[model samples]
Target: MHPGGIKTELGRHTDPVAEAQMIRTINQRNAAAGLPPFRYKTVPQGAATSVWAAVVADGDVVGRRYCEDCHVAQIAGDPEVRGGVQPYALDPDRADALWELSEAMVGERFDPLN
Candidate 1:
């Protein structure tokens, strides 16, 4: 949870130090919950892109800011470029699946199976 939200604060006026702190907070929460720490790679709204890097503990990559449903769609053949730069709470099933996956991925890297 970036304090200012990824979409809300991006671009030249953005604050890297603040964003890093926010990412650290998110990582701490995830670690405490036995989940993977996601290092935000890029945030793009409309067309612009911004990259964020974090020290991935245990080589893990997380989908913290992506819709699990869309992530599933992207994994499947939905013909839609689904993954996005924000977290979404769609339903119980999706949420459960994400939690399970996150737990399974603790201290491990996440390579999308596509």
Candidate 2:
């Protein structure tokens, strides 16, 4: 499902060559928009449908393991961070909160956005 809620169920692609072509098309579109190339991030279980999610890491979107509920964007000057999912007004505070929350998980720096 796309951020706009558009869903596409790519059923079993029996044609490997055709699947590759479709992927190439998607990659081209992403590249033209200055976004990262599309790659399978997760495989959703279902019928013969091919439900794929991409590792979306752009200036306006961040793809992470834990933070997947909301859309987060990369914050400049913080390369260590992947990105955050809040507006500028809530960034600093959210960062502090994430840092505190992460203290219990990983001891790494609380990088909210990159």
lDDT of 1 by residue, 1-114 (tens): 122234544455768799678778777766766666754433452222212213221213333332231122123222122233322353557777886789688966566453
User: Highest TM-score: which candidate?
Assistant: 1
Rate residue 19 of model 1 by lDDT: 69
Task: List the candidates' TM-scores in order.
Answer: 0.31, 0.30
Residues forming the 10-long window of minimal summed lDDT in candidate 1: 69-78
Segments in model 1 whose C-alpha atoms lie over 4 Å from true places: 1-9, 41-114
**RMSD in Å for candidate 2, one decimal?**
14.6
**Model 1 TM-score relative to the real fold:** 0.31
Clashing pairs in 1: 65-86
User: lDDT of each model, Cα atoms only?
Assistant: 0.44, 0.45
- Model 2, span 1-114: residue lDDT tens: 223212245545347798779778777766766666655533333211212224433523333322332333333333222223334434667667767878767766654565
Residue 2: error of model 2 in Å? 4.7
Candidate 2 Cα outliers beyond 4 Å, as residue runs: 1-10, 44-114
